[model samples]
Target: MQKPEIQQLLDKSFSDFTTFIGSLSDHRFIVSPEGKWSAGQQLDHLIRSAKPVNKALSMPRFFLRWFGKPAKASRSFEEIRDVYRDRLQHGAVSTRPYIPPVTEIGQRETLLKQFDQQKSKMIGLVGNWDEPELDRYQLPHPLLGKLTTREVLYFTIYHNYHHLHTLQLREKPEQPWPTQLERVIF
Candidate 1:
C-alpha cells in the first residue's frame, strides 16, 4: 500500500523520466555533445538504470532487513555499477567501443516502450510493502547517513530527476534556463 503522496511522486517521476527519454530524436541520440557519449549513450544509460531497481525488488525481506539499503542502491555513480553489471542479463551498455549500430527510429521507440514497461515492474515491486526495498531497514550514505526504506524511495526518484535535468539541458542548451526545473526539489 503506497501512501498517496509517495505514489504521486513516483507516478510523476515516471512520467517525467519517460518524457525526457522520449524527447531525444534518433539524431539527438547520436549527439554525445563532444564525442564523449551521444544522447544515445544517455538514453541507454537511463533504461539500464531500471535493472537495479528490479534487482532490489527481487531481494527477500530477510536479506533487505539485514543489509538495509546499500549506499548507492538507486543509481550507479561507481559504487553500484559493478553490482548492476553483474546482474544485467546482457551486460550494461558500454560507453566505450563506440559502435554506431544503426538503430532505427522504430527501434528507439521500442526501447522507450520497454523502459516504461520495466518501470511499471519497479513500481509494483516497491508499492505498499512492509519490507524495505533496500537490504537493511537503514543504511549509510556519504552525504546522508542512516536512511530508511522510505528515504530510499525519495532518493530513487530524486536521482531520476537529477539525470533528467542533465538530459533536459542536452535537449535545450540555448535557453538561459528555467527559474524552476522539474519538480522533485524536495
Candidate 2:
C-alpha cells in the first residue's frame, strides 16, 4: 500500500483494536482464555511490538540504512500474511521480548492510552518517508527476518487484525468465527 493508505490503515486498525479493548469488562479484560493471553496482555503485547517499529521508523535514514535494503522486491500484504500464518501453524510464537506480563484490570486505561500514543506516533513517523524510501530501507522482524519498510507496515496492519480476530473469537464463543484463511477480513 502507499504511504497515505498505510497510515490510514494503521490508524483504523489500532483505533478499532483499542476501542474494542477499552470496551471490555474488567473481568474479561484480565482473564485469559486457557493458555492464551488475556485481552489486557494482548494489548500489552501490541504496545510492546509497536515500540521497536516506531523506534525504527523514527530513526535517521542513515541509521536505518545500517539494516541494509531488501534483497528482492517487497512482498504483497497477502504474501506476508500467508507467511506469518504458515509460521504460526508450524509453532512460531512470540519471542521473549514480546511476551507480555500478567496485566491487571487497573492497568487497562493506561495500556489503552499507550497503544493510542504508539499508533499515533507510528502514523506520524510513517508520513516522513516517501514511497520509494519505504521500499529502499529494511528492518529486522523477529519472526519474519528483514523486511522492507513497506512490508513492515503491511505486517503491522495485518498483525492488528489478526489479534483482533483472536480476541473476537474469545469474546464471543457462541458465535461461529470464520474458519478459512480468507476469514481474516481486513
Candidate 3:
C-alpha cells in the first residue's frame, strides 16, 4: 500500500522469479510449447514491463505533475488486479514493444542481471516518494486507462504473479516447474 511495502513486493517478486528461472535449464527456458511463452520469454516480458517503470520514475516531478492530474481516489491493489484479469479473460494482449523475443540464446544471465538493476533502480525511486506523492501522481495503464503511482506499483506486484500463473498453467503435469507455483510468495 505504501512505498516500502510496494518496494518489498517488487524486490521479492523479481527475486522469486529469478530464482524460479535460475532453477530451469536453458532448453526448458527457451522452448515455447503449444504456442505459449517459454520460460525465458516470460522473464523477458517481466524485464520489459519493469524497464518502463524505471524510466517513468526517473523523470522530473514537475513533468509528471504537468502531464497528469492527481487521482480523485486511490484504487486498492485488488481492484487494479481484477481489472487486468478481466481484460486478459476478454482477449487483451501486451503491446508489441512489451512482448519479449522468443529466443535470446545464452542471454539468461545478462537478462537476469539487467532485471536486478532495474529492480534496484525502482526501489530507490519509490523510496524517495512518500504516500501522498504516490497517490498524487498518475501513470497511464493500457487496460485500466490511468493509475496512480501507488496503483502502478501494486499492478507490478500482481503482474509478476499473473505471468507466473500462466506459465505454470502451461507446464506439463510431470514437470517440477508446475509445483513451484504452489509456493508462490506473492
Candidate 4:
C-alpha cells in the first residue's frame, strides 16, 4: 500500500489499540486465578516489546538493500506460543498471557499509564514512516527473519493484537467494571 494510506491505517489501528489498552482494568484478577503475572505485568510485557520497537524506529532503516523482494517478515501464533513455553521453562513468566497481579497493588495504575504513553510514541513513530521507507535495509527479528523496517512494524501491529487476544483469553473480560470506580476501568 501507499505510504499515506498505510499511515492512515496505522493511525486507526493505533487508536483502537490505545482504546483497548485503556479499557483494560482487570488488575485485580490477572494473576490471582492463574498465579501468573498480573494484568500489570502483561502490560509490562507489551511496553517491553515497544523497547525494541523504539530502537528499530530510531535506526536509520533496515531496508536499504531491499528495493525489491518481499522485504518483510511474518509471524504466526504458534511461534509465539512456543516462545511462551520456552519462557516458562526458564522460570520467568513469559507474560504471554495478560493476567493482573494480585500482589503488587501499588503499581497497577502507573504501569498502565506508562503503557499508554509509550503506545502513543509508537504510533507517532509509525505515522512519520511508511512502507517505502521500509525498503532501506534488513534487520533480524528475534524469531521472524532479517526484514525491512516496514516488516518490523507489521510484526509490531500484529503482535499487539496477539497479546490482546491472549489477554482477552486470560481476563475473560466480558463483564463491565463497577459504576463508582476510580479509573472508569476495563
Candidate 5:
C-alpha cells in the first residue's frame, strides 16, 4: 500500500478494534477464557507491539538506514500474512516483550487511550516519509526479521486485524474456540 492507504488502514483498523473493545462489558473486557487473552489484554498487546513500529517510524532516516536496505524486494501484504500464519502453525508465539500483563477492568479506559495515542503517533510519523522512503528503509520485526518500512506497515495493519479477529471470536464462546493458529490466521 502507498503511504496514504497505509495511514488510512492504520487509522481505520485501530479505530475499529478500539471501538469493539470499548463496547464490551467491563467484566468481559477483563475476563479471558481458558488460556486466552481477554479483550483488555489484547488491547495491551497491540499497544506493546505498536510502540516499536512507531519508534522506528519516528527515527531519523540516517538511524533507520543502519539496518540496511532489503536484500530482496519487500513482501506483499499477503506474503507477510502467509509467513506469519506459517510461523504460528509452527509454534511461533509472542516473545517476552510482547506478552501483555493481566489487564484489569479498571484499566480499560487507560489502555484504550494508550492505543489511540500510539496509533495517532504512528500515523503522523508515517506521513513524514515519501513512498520510496518506505521501501528504502528496513526495520527489525521480532518474528519476521528485517522488513522494509512498507512491509512493517503491512504487518502492523494485519496485526491489528489479527487481534481484532481473536477478540471477535472471544465474543462467541458457544461456538467452539478456534485453535491457536486458527484464532489469528483465519
Candidate 6:
C-alpha cells in the first residue's frame, strides 16, 4: 500500500497542478517568455515524464529487482530535489523525446487532460506498491544514477513545482526598468 504521507503528497501535487492549469487563460497557456517553454509545453513535458514512471511502477516486483541494482541509500525528498535542481542550473536539458511539442492555440485542454490522466495512473500504480517495494526497487535516473522507487515519486512532485515556478515567472508583468532606459541612466 502507498504510505499515507506519499499518498498525501501525490494528492496535493495533483490538486495543485489541476488548479494551476484551470486558472490559466488559453493564450497564457501557450505563451513562453523569450526562449523558455510555454506553460502548456511544461505540462506536456510532465505528462511525458510520468509515462515511463507509471510503466515502471506496473512492472512486476521480481522484474524490477532482477533487472535493477540496489540503490546506494534512500535519500530524502529534499536531497533528490536539490541534486535535480543543481543539474538543471548547470545546464542539463530534457532529452529530445521528452521535450513537448510547441504549444499551439486550443491545445491547453488536450494537454491538461493528458496530464491529469497520467498523474492518476501514476498515483494508482504507486499506491498499489507497499513500503517495502518502494524502498527495495531501484531505477536509473538520467542524471542522479540509481534511485529507489520512492525517490522517483518525489521527483515527480517537485518537478511540477519547478515548472510551476517557471510558468509563474513568465506570467509576471515586467515591472523592472527597461534595459535601454537603465543603460542610458547608468
Regions of model 5 farther than 4 Å from truth: 173-186
**Steric collisions counted per model:** 8, 0, 0, 15, 0, 1
Candidate with the larger lDDT of 2 and 5: 2
Q: Where is model 4 more than 4 Å wrong at Cα?
A: 4-32, 62-103, 173-186
Residue pairs with backbone atoms closer than 3 Å in model 2 (clashes): none
Per-residue CA lDDT of model 6 for 28-147, tens digit only, reads 677654667877888888888888889899998887876576646677889989999999889998988789889886777787788878877887887799887788889877777778
TM-score of 2: 0.92
Least well predicted 10-residue stretch by lDDT in candidate 2: 177-186
- Tens-place lDDT digits, model 4, residues 1-186: 445544565555545655665665455434434344545565666667767676666655543343344433433334544554465467753343333334364666676677667666766776667555555545555554465565565556656666666556654445543432323332
TM-score of each: 0.59, 0.92, 0.89, 0.60, 0.91, 0.87
lDDT of 5 by residue, 1-186 (tens): 778898999999899999999788787788776668888889999999999999998888999878987898878999999999898889999999999999988898899999999999999999999988988999988888999999999999999999999888766756544453356555
Candidate 2 local Cα displacement, residue 57, angstroms: 0.4
Q: Which window of 10 residues has the lowest lDDT sum in candidate 1?
A: 177-186
Q: What does the lDDT come to for candidate 1?
A: 0.54
Ranking by TM-score: 2, 5, 3, 6, 4, 1
lDDT of every predicted structure (CA atoms): 0.54, 0.89, 0.81, 0.55, 0.89, 0.78
lDDT tens per residue, model 3, 91-171: 999989888876675888888888888888989999888788888888887777778888889898898888777766666
Candidate 3 lowest-lDDT run of ten:
177-186
lDDT tens readout by residue for model 2, 50-145: 999999999999998789868999999999999999999999999999999999988998999999999999999999999999999999999999
Clashes of 3: 0
Query: In model 2, which regions exceed 4 Å deviation?
Result: 173-186
In model 5, what are the clashing residue pairs, if there are any?
Answer: none
Between prediction 1 and prediction 3, which has the larger TM-score? 3
| Candidate 6 Cα outliers beyond 4 Å, as residue runs | 173-186
